[model samples]
Target: MKAMILAAGLGTRLRPLTLDRPKPLVDVHGRPLIEYNLLLLRRYGIVDVIINLHHQGDALRAALGSGDTLGVRIVYSPEDPLLDTGGAIKNAASLLGDDDFLVLNGDTIIDLPLDALLAAHRARRAAATLVLRHDPEQQRYGLVEIDGEERIRRFLGRPAEVETALVPYMFAGVHVLSSRVLDYMPDPGTTFSITRATYPAMLAADEGLYGFPFAGFWRVIDTAADLARANAILEERPPLHFL
Candidate 1:
């Protein structure tokens, strides 16, 4: 399987620390943030990894050289004007190729059962399976509503309104997507957020998009406080214990 990590963000939220290094290269428990994701991908037997870079991109490139130490082949998609999530994925389409691949946020730390998520994706025969978790504060972030069969009924903060018994779950910054999803995106654009544009279109078309609910430890490390919490958790005990 192949995968791409969206790492081109400027890390505006993580100031001072990110001023000198990219968010992906920011130290957390002695290892660069992106390194953890690479190791996790290696464990899942996914070696073909593509990462996009912009903020302190050269440092990140130097730090991750060829991913040899991590047992994976790392490829880079260097973007000049930072592209948003949808734009970055669309820009790296050639590297992603013509099949389904895993997409994850470079800064998110989550102990996801990759095999289980993939299995659930295939069973549902979904066009895309979003790794979702039911968070009480789901309103803070973009939410996805899924039915009993796990098919996505609607995406929050979008125009598509569904009257079904929909449970809102926060997107876990991880997904298994078919290349076909790009069909809804423009070839070249300034910036586009996938949640704001693509997923809603898919939902309106009644396309098979499902949520892979995982009640596990997951954190999106964007601010310094998030990094501190992660370090405390990882330093005090092994991450596997929480899993």
Candidate 2:
């Protein structure tokens, strides 16, 4: 399996902590935030990885050179002007090759059965399978609606109106995407968002978009409080089983 870590964000939410380093490089329990994702990918036996870089790109590069220490072959796609999720993936289309690949947010720490997620994606033959979780603050993160069959029906808050009062599920910042979904993305070199643009289009077209609900440990460290909480969690439970 192959994976891509979306680490190109400017980390504006993290402010002072990110001023010296990228959000992915922010220290969490004495380990870089991105390290948790890398280790998880390694745990799943996905050794080929690409990381998109922007703010503090050099520091990230210096922090994890070639992914050798982590037992993964790492390549970088540095965007001059940071491209959002859609554009970043399109920019690395060639490197990702013509197969399904995993996408993980650098700021998130999650421990779930990735193998099962892959199995479900293959079984459904979905073009894009998002890992969803029931977050109480769904509105804060934006919601995704899924049907009985787990097909993604809509991206809440989009321009389109959803007739049904569908329950909202938060995107877990993890995705298993088939290469063909890249076609739904805007032209390469253009800044775009997968949620606001590509995903809505895919749902409209009835493409094979699905969701896998996960009830496990997942945290996104976007603010100082989040960072502190993560550190506290690690302090209470040193050496997370996932890592």
Candidate 3:
């Protein structure tokens, strides 16, 4: 299987730490944040990966090299002006191939059953299956509204009408996407967001956009406080299985 780590963000939220390096290279629990995702991908038997680079792109390249140390073959997609999630994935379309592939946020640490997520995606034959979790701050983090059937009905705020009692779920920054989802990608070389652009359109068309609710360990290292919390969590409960 193949996967792509979205590592091209400027990491403005991380401040001075990211001022010197990219978010993917930001240290979390004594290791680069992106490394956790790399290890997770390896555990799932995914050996081929693509990583988008921007905001200290060279540093990220130097840090990860050819992904040899992690046991995965990595090809880089360099964005001159950082493309958002949607554009980044579209930029690497050639490498991702014409099949389902995994996409993970570079700065998140998650230990969910990726194999089961893959199975669910295949069973539903969804255009995109996002990994979501119940978060009290879901609305604050731009909640994803899903129906009882687990189909994603809206993201952030869309449809502008409430028909059913939608459950608020936060995007876990991990998703399994069919190559066909690329069809909804914005024009090449354009900056776009999957959540702000692609997802809403797909939902409007009634495409099979599903969500897998995960009740497991997940964290996004976006700030100093978040980093500290992550370190504390790891200290209390070592991620021996994930690491």
Candidate of highest lDDT? 2
TM-scores, all models, native as reference? 0.92, 0.95, 0.94
lDDT by residue for model 1 (51-169), tens: 99898999999998998988999999988788799989998988999989999999988888899999988887789999989766556567788788788877776232443355578
Error of 2 at 191 (Å): 0.3
lDDT of 1 at 88: 90
Better of 1 and 3 by TM-score: 3
Please give, for residues 72-104, the per-residue lDDT of candidate 3 as tens digits: 889999998878889999999988999899999
Misplaced by over 4 Å in model 1 are 158-166, 241-243
> What shift in Å separates residue 116 of candidate 3 from its native position after superposition?
0.5
Error of 1 at 77 (Å): 0.8
Whole-model Cα lDDT per candidate?
0.85, 0.88, 0.87
How do the residues 95-165 of candidate 2 rate in per-residue lDDT, one tens digit apiece? 99998999998899998788999999999999999999887655557578888999988887533244457
- Which ten-residue region of model 3 has the weakest summed lDDT? 157-166
Error of 1 at 122 (Å): 1.3
Q: What clash count does candidate 2 reach?
A: 0
Error of 2 at 144 (Å): 0.5
Could you arrange the candidates by lDDT from highest to lowest? 2, 3, 1
